[model samples]
Target chain A: MSILTALARLLIFPGILFAVPAAWFFLWVERKSVAMMQGRIGPPFMQPFFDFIKLLGKSTPQRTGVAGALMRAWPLIAVSTAAGAVGLLPVLPSSGGFQGDLILLLALLEVPSICIIAAGFTSRSIFGEIGSAREAVLSVSYNVVFLLAIISVAASQHTFRLEALAQAPATSLRWIGILAVLICLPAKLHLNPFSLPNAEQEIYSGPMVEFAGPELAMWELSHGLEWVAATGLVATLIAPQMAFWGLSALAFVALSFGIVLLLSALAAATARLAIDTTVRFYWQCTIIFAVLAVSSALLMRLRS
Target chain B: MNLWKRLMCYCRRRSPWLFHLNSGSCNGCDIEIVAALAPRYDAEQLGVRLEGSPRHADILCVTGPVTRNAVCAIKTVYGQVCGPKAVVAIGSCPATTNVFIDSRTLDGPLGKHIPVDVFVPGCPPRPDAIIEGVAKAAQILAERGDEVPEVITAAEVQA
Candidate 1:
């Protein structure tokens, strides 16, 4: 494929357009699953889409000048970064970007959280500040364990390219590493047990407390993208590799949806972890899992 | 303009986030509102969420008669909701000041201060009635083209 097609693919297919709809679908999946978990019929499947429309159509709210600028920038920044990262994964394994590709992917994923932190601080709402501080501390708590988990994925392969992982058979140790990464997924997505930053019952929207109208639409639209990114990352790392894999986008999508369901069930079943407890749990338990996965990866390597 | 109008109507009808205000209720109606969101009612299943901030809400579900101090807060919160919004007065007190009518501190019958689009009227309306009022408000909100809120009569609500 030429540069133009690749650019087109990145800009159109699986870009904002594809990613946006998929994101919306994933959000519907989330709410529906949570509703089912709580024994309710849940919103119409179009709830997420309707929410985006309603927010966009409403009048915009006010914020200070600099804060306003940043708030406006945040959703665009968040959604685009996540969508761009999705492009790199190339739904087709044949059209893939190579090893150490994951490093770029990892960096891209971090941008959204950083933008959220910036949004919380820049918006100047009290809850926004509290949320920003929470996100900052939470990121600190999870970054090392998350990084180690990523490194373990790399350790299982000879090359550092993300594409290699799709083709690399999943080993028991690698699965252990993936499971270790899965433990961090809830925190990464701010689902239950780690949903501290925006604990609705406790803080009433945290960083997003002050945002309204189109600004909030963008905030939520980016959230859909983030959900896709989270599940996509997990799917990429763990999807089974067979001769004709990645050809069936449907299967991979189903894989992601299953992961979303798992995460949502986990989120709905648990309460938000307190800040200190979140930090401690990440430090103690997840860290141990990461160390265990990494050591086992090394042990397997030495044996080979 | 036409497409925008349709999108507004359809989307507003599909999702209506609410903000609750307890004017001066005995907490009976307040608890019922909470009950509407509990497992049996689970208003969220129908796309009605209880929002923390007024700015995020499409419906203001206010319970109780208006109190002297709460009257100002109620209006302020109503103004804060992004438009094409609706207000559902959750109890008889908010509808007609209920038993608090003779109380000196009362300033309720919520419509006097803020136009109430719907009223769920029992001293403490059932959770189902509260759900109906909110749902009714969502429909009214979707159809509003700057329509002024007129109080729904007791007869109309019962019908």
Candidate 2:
């Protein structure tokens, strides 16, 4: 393929244009589902889109020097990196990804969390600092399981390419690895039970306490992109590949929406756990899932 | 560009995230404000969300009589919210200092501190009433000009 086609693939399909809108849709699904579960009427379908627009239209406060520049840059970095991760998703099986792209996707996916941490500290607010500290700790704790889960799945499939992973047959080991990944999603997305980093009641939006107007809008957009990228990864692995690109893309979106509903139920049903409790819970799951993943991969290798 | 501007105005009306501030209320108006956002009332259907931080809020809902102690805090919070914002004074206390009109500790009638766009009457207004007030404030926000309205208190009006 020429560089133009590659650019089209990266900048159009499964990229910023597609991912940003899908992110808004998924966010709406999450909110609407949670509201239904709680017996309340949620906002309209266009609520998230409207919110983004309203925020962009509002006037922002002035800031000076390095802190201001970094604050402005962090959300852009987050948005670009997350969109890149989503772009790397094997939504269409024949999209043509290179070898070891799974690792590149993982690295890209991790950039948002890093950006959030840096953004919090850069804001120089006490709540932002506290949020940054909590995010730092939680990122470390959950990534142990997150990394191991993806690695074990890769080991079972015997390939590090995302397209190959999507095309590979699902084994019991792969399912277990996927289960481990699901456990990490709540913490990563800042949903209930693992939402300590941005506990709005206690810390006042934590890292985002100081952000307003277009800057905050960028952060919100980046968050929505993260929803797309993370869930899209899980969806790609579990969704069955089809002979046609169109069918594969449809299945990919449908499965991702299903995961969003499942996650919304979990978020609505649970309460925020204490930071210590959340850390302990993730470590325990890591140990159990680690054993299952490692043992299952070893079994697969031994059988082969 | 005109269409874009109009669309923005439409969006501003549609989504109004609120930050609730209690200058010194008796908790009656506070409960009513909560009730407005509760399941039965569901202000969220109108895209009215209760935000935690002032910076993220488009509407500031001030409850209760402005007490002497809360005066500074209220000003600080009002300053934090981004522009193109609206203020809704909930309950009669914020509008006229209510029954505590003679209370020495109070420095209220919220309009004295910040410009208020909407006032919901009643000592402790009903949930429906509070929601209506918020919706009205959101409308004001959508059409509001870039300039924050100059606050003219009763004393100033009399003068």
Candidate 3:
């Protein structure tokens, strides 16, 4: 097969197909796993798909005083970015991974966060504004930790290529890199304990308060994909020795998703930390872990 | 197709989303509703989602007797919920206004505002009873048609 033909095949078919289902399944796993940890039977494995279908069929209510066109289009932008980020990650065996730079991939994930904040702010509702503010605070708190963790991984592996990071040796120092990655995982997934922005009890679903119908479904799909991408990054970094082909990626995805579920359950079983407390916890707690991991990586590099 | 519809009706009978409306209640029943979602009684496992908006909801779980001031809000919320909906009069207050029956501010015994599908009798019904009431409401929802019964009047019930 010609290189150009193979590249074209990779970009269009597997890249798009891999993202939608992977994202949906990851969401299902998170819900079921959290339910199991809490000692309850969670929603069915296909619940997210069913929910998206149902939401799509419902009426889309426009918020009073918001610019109609902007509100309608924001979710599309968010979902597109989320899907784009999936391409940047090495979830599928196909090629075209270089369509995104490392910084571009990170920015793609942030697009949804920005859209969430914008949606909330545009709604002209008090709850919407408060939710947007909380989301802003959360973004500020975690953005640095996420960047530092990613930088640590890049520095240790000596390449910004996600595939290269996955192929890097699993040395003792890699364990530290693993810890830094783990701390950033919940932040990226928007799971419990780290779920300050969209706290259902406090802000009535935060930025999602006014969202309904197909717009809500798109946002939900993006969220599901974000969960997949975050967990996939962790699995790829920690256990690259696992095969990267079809079912091997599936197995690694499942294992990583299970780990995230256990963590979410732990978060749910515990009471919510105050916003200030959460901010303090992420900055202080994550920084300590990241620094230790980086130091270990440096020591290993010198010894080698 | 017939069997599938019947099975869906059966599942809907067992599970109903309870859309709680405060309508000036003292929040006693609200706490009970929350208790129903906790681990011991977890209604979520049964497919009972406590949705925020009335439009997306299936069952209207009204708490407290209707105060004169809140009567309009209650009616508005009830109207907003789509068809095939059921009204559950949660707590004794909404059912009869209970201790507040004599208050000048009360226009209640919630049946005055909307059709009451199932009456859960308690000052604040236990979480188990709330679950049972929700199940009953779901059954009513599945069976509802264009020929919904006329609103039951207080005078007719007393007679």
The number of the candidate with the highest TM-score is: 2
Q: If the candidates were sorted by their DockQ against the true structure, best first, what order would they fall in?
A: 2, 1, 3
Q: For residue A12, what is the lDDT in candidate 2?
A: 80
Global CA lDDT of candidate 2, please? Answer: 0.87
**lDDT tens digits by residue: candidate 2, A100-199:** 2899999999999999999999999999999999999999999989988999999898888887898899988899899999999999999998998899
Query: Model 2 Cα RMSD, Å?
Result: 2.8
DockQ-based CAPRI category assigned to the predicted complex of candidate 2: high
Q: Pick out the ten consecutive residues of candidate 1 chain B with the lowest summed lDDT.
A: B150-159
Better model by lDDT, 1 or 3? 1
lDDT of 3 by residue, B1-159 (tens): 486455545544544556789877889888998888777888876667787656456689899889999999998988766555688888888888988878999898888779888888787788898877887777676666324557663211110
Error of 2 at A266 (Å): 0.8
Clashing pairs in 1: A42-B45, A98-A161, A99-A160, A99-A161, A100-A160, A100-A161, B66-B108
Spell out the clash pairs found in candidate 3.
Answer: none
lDDT of 3 by residue, A100-196 (tens): 3566777888898899899888766687788788888888888777777677677777677766666678766667766776776666566777777
Provide the TM-score for each candidate, comma-separated: 0.92, 0.96, 0.81
Task: Supply fnat for every model shown.
Answer: 0.81, 0.94, 0.12
The reply for model 1, stretches above 4 Å from the true place, is A95-100, A242-246, A295-304, B146-156
Stretches of model 2 off by over 4 angstroms after superposition: A95-100, B151-159
Candidate 1: tens digits of C-alpha lDDT, residues A1-304: 5576577657765567678888889888888888888888887878898999998878766656776788889978987888888776645545533322788888888898998888888877788899889999999989888888878778867656776777688777677777877888888788888988887777778887777888888888888887887778778777766556445466668778899989999988998778999999989888997888777767767887
- What TM-score results for chain B when candidate 2 is compared with the true chain B? 0.92
